[model samples]
Target: MNLRRLKYFVKIVDIGSLTQAAEVLHIAQPALSQQVATLEGELDQQLLIRTKRGVTPTEAGKILYAHARAILRQCEQAQLAVVNAGQALNGQVSIGLAPGTAASSLTMPLLQTVREQLPEVLVYLHENSGSSLNDKVMHGQLDMAVLYDRAPTAGITSTMLLKEELYLIGAGDSPGHNVDLADVAQMNLFLPRDYSAVRKRVDEAFSLRRLSARIIGEIESISTLTAAVASGMGVTVLPESAARVLVSSTNAWMSRITSPTLNLPLSLNVSSRLPLSPSAQAVKNILLSLLSKPTIEDRELMLVG
Candidate 1:
């Protein structure tokens, strides 16, 4: 449990010999052995089994080792962060953006702000399906992500940003005022595969209306999808903001989804499983604060579209 004991344990396991660990640690073999024994006692578990060559950790020891490594690394980072707190914030931040409306809204502002405020910090931006982003966030691979507000997952935290209404996107010549969900069954639709969050919701909405979407094509890339819609391959349903951005890209128009209007709340997701680095937390704060203000107005999105 003690930090020093954990270090001793990990060193011994790494070097495969108590004598070598003591040599590397500049401590006596007897002292190192005592520290490990004390650690095992505190946990009431057998941590190591003596081997002819040196030592090997028990199953419990492996678990402890993994956690101990992370803890020690975090502690070291905390110290460095304090030392550099007065200076420019410098750390790597990996953020995930759900393609379409999310990119048009959050990506530029975040990049511009971080460049101005934390020039020393490095940012990695990834755009993918909402479900993909959520998976990465849930696994701690991403520091934060933007996803739809859905039923809670175990290790991810969500803060609802805006309840965006759905819209029907089609070629510019296509005309419709308020399209009903059930009517989608009659039109050829281009949608992401079933794994995608948007497709899942779209399918559910149709099912609720006792209708099935006439899906003519499956495209994962948002760019390809917009091009397909522009060429009049088929129509797709999108959030109001996303619809605006997509329509602006090509000759397209949008009609609000009505008749049991569907509204999906966009949320900012962060991993609750691990403590975010100081830089990441700072970025997270900026994100939530910015989103708490008014969402992108229809006029603002006109530029991106």
Candidate 2:
């Protein structure tokens, strides 16, 4: 397909008026109409429905519009890659980090790395729930995200970054140890809301054993949750990375949940349909490199592709 004709078609569909598209393209309306006609002829499909008010894409046109957008975006990225070749990448790349996992802790390191390596690239970090971040990534609102693998991956590509074993965090500072799932289930728990990916996993694991977790409250904030755990109000489940931080700072302890190992896989996700810009790809590479390295605090984390 002719890139120019596809561009004209997209603009017309966006504005819903060939006249306006011509005005924006600085071309005659007849020429713009001819371009669309030629595009429709080439594709052998009726792409639009024109009426007195405006034009709307036909079923085929809707499909074509989506593909055209992806194609155009890839073309733009290619142009940028060529232009910025052998030069430092400089652009804004937004990434989402789902809370309640080790992924959330990478915000500072990500910023520091970008500042040191890709100084010209500006990073925008979004810390949110996995489902929220997943939606943002699928919609192309974010360049990439680190989310739990439990989230739906229908419209995005997710590569497992690491697997973190869940730990039961509770009061008492006797070094960390193993805690059976049956025993841990009896404790009053404070976990994220049911909609959260971690919460769903916790619930599913309990359901499989025909036992229910005694959850006292839903806590999303780490500080509040840790405070509650430290005050002996209740226990909460967290990955080793987050549990380590809680135990180090608070009068609390973390025990690896066993008797049915529950591990949450953290994955790096990006849109499957849209291509990443050069700057975004560079930041993604940095994230992969940083997260892949082994650390003392997260020694048990199982790194994946």
Off by over 4 Å in 1: 1-76, 295-305
Clashes of each: 1, 0
lDDT of each: 0.79, 0.85
Collision count of model 2: 0
Off by over 4 Å in 2: 1-79, 82-86, 173-176, 298-305
What are the per-residue Cα lDDT tens digits for candidate 2 across 1-305?
87898889889988999888899999999988888888889999999999999999999998888778777778877888898899989978999987766766777888999999999999998888887887777655688988777655787899998888898988864434888889878888999998787788899899998888999999999888878898887899888888888888987878888878898888999989898998998899999998987675546544432
Candidate with the greatest TM-score versus the true structure: 2
Q: Write the per-residue lDDT of candidate 1 for residues 1-305, one digit (tens) a residue.
A: 77888778878887889888999999999988899889999999999988888999899998787667657656756886888877877878888887764545767788888888778888888887777787677544678888765668766788887778878899855558887776767888998788766777788888888887899999877789898998887999887878888888888989887777877778888866567788888888877766666555744767677
Error of 2 at 175 (Å): 10
